[model samples]
Target: MDRLSRFARRIFALGAGSSMALVFLVIFVNSVRRYTIGKSIAWGEELPIYLTIYGVMFGIAYAYMTDSHIRFAVFLDMLEEKIKRFVLIACDLLTAATGVTLIFAGHAFAMRRGSVASSGLKSTGDWLAQITGIPWLEWVGKVGTWQYAIVLGGAMLAIAAILRLSERLSAPSKAKEPVAPLAAPAGKAST
Candidate 1:
């Protein structure tokens, strides 16, 4: 399980990094073209938006897997150790629930948008088909394609949350230190 989680984390990182890199390159080249030749690639604007969405979605998963996401720990710190553990478990459950919600919402939205198409992406598909010599690639530009990122992100989040909850539950609880009196003994009182 540990190894699998590591592998998943790596995949998430790669997906996010690659998407960001591609988005940057496309936007840069398009900007250069627009400035130098007064023309922009048809897919430049559309492609970057989709890439950014994918990048952000994957990055969220990567963050969750790596325990890099932010948490407000001030209140948690005030709780007893055992209560803290339960609270953490509850938080994980909530996160998993949210992820599940996203999964359903994203799936429904993607399905509904399946028939909708983007002209810019169609042009992109045509260009890609010409360059790659794949005749069928011309139909690759569906608006619903990028919407699947929400599903992917949600799945990753739910899985990571479940794994974390399991690990937390299986781990041995820490022994709390015995509380000492606030006031020092007469012999040990401060001068």
Candidate 2:
């Protein structure tokens, strides 16, 4: 399980990095074309926006896996070990619940916009389908924005939250301290 989680984290990081790169390339090319050629790709703005949305969504999962997200540790740090463990468990439970909500909401949102075809992606999909000769590729070729935003992002977030909760629940508790024997008063030494 640990190995699987690590593998998943790596995959998420790769996806985020790839998306970020794509966005950067698209924006750079669009800028160059507009300035140098006095013309811009009609779909340039939309494509990079979508890629950025996907990148940020996947980045959230990567952050969670790496434990790099922001923490309000001022109060938590002051807690006793046992109490801190309990508090962490409670926080995990809350995060899990939020993930579940996102999953459901994202599904519904995706479904609602599933039939709406994106103008920017539709043409790109058609071109790819022609080159690849894959009929089913066109289906994803014309996906709605919600499919990228809610479906992919929300699903990844939910999965990350669940994995994090499981890790917290199964982690071993901190070892207890060894207590020293109490000494008798200096003037009165008993048997």
Candidate 3:
């Protein structure tokens, strides 16, 4: 489990780094192009947008492992113990449900749109026509694109991770702060 989690973290980190680098590089390239050529690459903005979207999609797992995502703690904290547990469980369930919905809905959406080939926001998908001379790699683009697959896989992974977290949350966590006493009744011992 630890190994798997570590691998997931590494994958997420790599995606994030690649996304940021591409975004910055794209901006830099665009500025340079616009300065020198009096215009920018039409594809520059699109590439960065894709990278940003990819990063967000891939960052979910990392967010979970790092606990970096925001949580609304005030209401949760104010709840009594049993209610807190129930609320946590419900939150987990809702997260998992959302993940599952994304998986199915995204897959359906992708299927409907996957047939449309990208012209790269600039050219007429001509890049692939000339690059296939080697023959073996000819059908690469014709093959199903991995981006959609990533969406489906990511949604499943996200849901699975949520369920795993749900199970973990069900068990009492030992790393919690030392158990504190409830307020003492008037006659109770102080200790």
Candidate 4:
């Protein structure tokens, strides 16, 4: 389990970091070209948008894996220990369910829209064709190619949620803080 978690952490971190780097690189290059030569790559706009989506998805999974995702700690703190445990477990289950839903929904959406191609990417294909013998552009010009990031993010989220659930189940409960005593039953003889 530890090894699996470590692997997932690495993958999520690398994916998010790489996506951000690529987006930055592409935008920088495009800006330089536009300013210096008064021309920018046709697909520059579209590529960065897709890469940003990928980066956000990976970053979300990475945040959840690191236990940094949002939570209502104030509400949770108000509950009894056992109820808190139950609520935590339930929350984990809910997160896992959401992830699974994303997987199926994303897959269906991608398949339904897979045939449509982006005009920018289609034009960019010509640029790539000059270098590669294979028709790689045709494969990736479709929106569905990048939409798979949704599915990938869903899978990572599910894995992280389940791992957290397991850890929660195995860990010992924390000691609750002592509650203050009542006001001596409204001053009963002061003793």
Candidate number of the best lDDT:
1
Distance from true position, residue 180, model 2, in Å? 9.7
* Candidate 2, superposed: residue stretches over 4 Å from native: 129-146, 175-191
In order of TM-score, best first, we have: 4, 1, 2, 3
Estimate, for each residue in 1-191, the C-alpha lDDT of model 1 and write its tens digit.
Answer: 67777888898899999999999999999999999999999888898998899899889888887778888778888888899999988988998898899999999999899646776798777778899999867655878777888998898889878877777788888669889858876788665
Global CA lDDT computed for model 4 = 0.85
Of the pair 1 and 3, which is ahead by TM-score?
1
Collision pairs in model 3: none
TM-score of 2: 0.78
Clash pairs, candidate 2, are: none
User: For candidate 4, lDDT tens digit of each residue in 54-118?
Assistant: 99898888888787888898998899998999998898899889999999999998888877787
Residue 20's lDDT in candidate 1:
97
Task: Tell me how many residue pairs clash in candidate 2.
Answer: 0
Ranking of candidates on lDDT, top first? 1, 4, 2, 3
The list of candidate 1 runs beyond 4 A from truth reads 126-139, 178-191
Error of 3 at 132 (Å): 3.2
Structure candidate 1, residue pairs in collision: none
Please name the candidate that would achieve the greatest TM-score relative to the true structure: 4
Worst 10 residues of 1 by lDDT: 114-123
Q: Where does the lowest 10-residue lDDT sum fall in candidate 3?
A: 137-146
